[model samples]
Target: MMRAADLPGVIPVFPLPGALLLPRARLPLHLFEPRYLAMLDDVLKTPHRLIGMVQPDPNPRAAQEDAPPPLHSIGCAGRVTQFSETEDGRYMITLAGISRFRVTEEVGGFCPYRRVKPSWEGFDRDLARSEKDTGFKRESFLDLLSRYFQAKSLDTDWETLKEADDEMLINSLSMLLSFDPEEKQALLEAPSLSTRRETLVTLIEYALRGGDDHGLLQ
Candidate 1:
């Protein structure tokens, strides 16, 4: 159980587009980029092996600028639960999600990676187990997922998926799906588990109906 006070006032952030991390979810990352590798190294030396996963703004102008791209306000903080170094000097790491936070402000520093002050006050409920009954339309959601998988020619282990609890299934599907950056951010910023589930179902349905994926960013 993590209390709001236990969370650091400032933490390193990795702004990746289309990547979503939800509370209590797990995100596996490949850290080959120099800046991220340095961030990982610093985090490993600290007592709080934590990192915030955020998504970069989708605006084209943000990418054209020399400065760091703007980031979405909400993100999930995760602890470095597993790590290994590859022979090629790359890092394989797994982050176990802790809680969701809102970025209060960005801190300027000499470090290559960006850091921000996180406000966890409004997201304290993320520390607890999500409601057991997410009110998700499980059967319809699964049916749509199956269709979408077939459409994408993706394979999955149905048995394993069936064994997952409600929260795990929802979060896993949300992370695994190839949603647009804005859609991913919307899921990350959803006010509650049930709301996230509903949004996910809608997305899956839209995909199944052969809706234009590009329109999702709007």
Candidate 2:
């Protein structure tokens, strides 16, 4: 568990739209782009070795601007838990999520990659497991999930999925499913584990009913 003070005041951000990382989850990344490769190199020398995974706002106006695309206010910070340099000079790394943070202000024109002062005060719950015995509709979720897999022609080890704990199941599905950027961001910003689970269920149900082309395999 990281205390508030222990968290970095400013962290480098990787603004990947639709890629989401939740606290206690692991997100594997291939760092090939020059700016990101440089970001990782700088992180290696620092003690924190942390990177913020944020999503770029999808508005067309935001995209048309000369500056980098605007980012959502919230994102999860992850520690570089695994790292290896390939002969081709690309970095293969796995980040273990630490906590969620809200960007208070962007500190610009310094690093090639973006940096922000993050506020961790509102997301202390991310540091600890949820104590609320918020029950999950496992059978219903799995049933809909099975339908979703079949619809998308996706394969999975049902035995392993069944064995996953509640938190793991919810977070894993949230990460693995091909949701739109806004939907993924909504999951990341959910106030609690229970709320995320509920939101996931609603999204899955919407997909099952053929609500949006974005929910289909992409």
Candidate 3:
């Protein structure tokens, strides 16, 4: 029930790898590190308890470093809707994605994790409009994904996939696909569900044509 206009537009940050949070999606996090545990504490006490979810680059050594990655300029801001403290001092929290935010500036010294002032001019406005399937493009996108998986011999539950809702299909594919960081960011920043759907179709087609020339499907 928090008002968007009243949000501080800034809050403490938690960076987790392989996590892509989209507007309207929910992310469950296990908070263990001292820095992030303190972050959970501060979030629980704040009026606008939002956290920016961004992934670190693909490096085991880099991930173990004490600092967060240089985050992509754009990320989704999600409010801590569910929280629980375990007996072992860890935290289980779920963030309900609210809006897309731009990192305006970083604030230091709150905790080991960083904080940022966000710009949320076009947060979740897409929710007001009905999402329309772009017809042939979507089907083609699914076909490409299917063929790519087959070509790579990856096992997936096609029956379950076929029954997924539009949002579920698009977001799950976007998350599950081995897209590069820049491409993934593009999907994150796409203004509308339709826009993201189109981008996914394009990326899939590119992968189909071997334009990526990498082991994306594998």
- Order candidates by lDDT, high to low: 2, 1, 3
Q: Estimate the TM-score of every prediction.
A: 0.92, 0.92, 0.76
The regions of model 3 sitting more than 4 angstroms off are 1-3, 55-69, 84-87, 124-130, 134-138, 209-218
lDDT of candidate 3 over 1-218, digit per residue (tens) = 44566567577766665567876677788989988987777777987778888654454444435755666567777889998889998989988876777777678764677888877766647333335455535566667888888766778988887787777788777867777766777788788778888788877777778775443422
Q: Write the per-residue lDDT of candidate 2 for residues 1-218, one digit (tens) a residue.
A: 56667798889999998899999889999999999999999998988899999998766665654777788889999999999999999999999888999998888876888999998888888888743426887787789899989988999999999998888888888998988988998899989889898889888888878886474322
In terms of lDDT, which candidate is stronger, 1 or 2?
Answer: 2
User: Predicted candidate 1: what Cα RMSD to the true structure?
Assistant: 1.9
Q: Kindly report which residue stretches of model 1 are placed more than 4 angstroms away from their true locations once superposed.
A: 60-66
TM-score of 3: 0.76
Residue 115 C-alpha lDDT in model 1? 97
Worst 10 residues of 2 by lDDT: 209-218
In terms of lDDT, model 1 sits at: 0.86
Task: Give the alpha carbon lDDT tens digit for every residue of 111-182 in model 1.
Answer: 989999998888877888664644767777678788889998999998888778888998888898888888
**lDDT (CA) per prediction:** 0.86, 0.87, 0.72
- Runs with alpha carbons beyond 4 Å of true place in candidate 2: 60-65, 130-133, 214-218
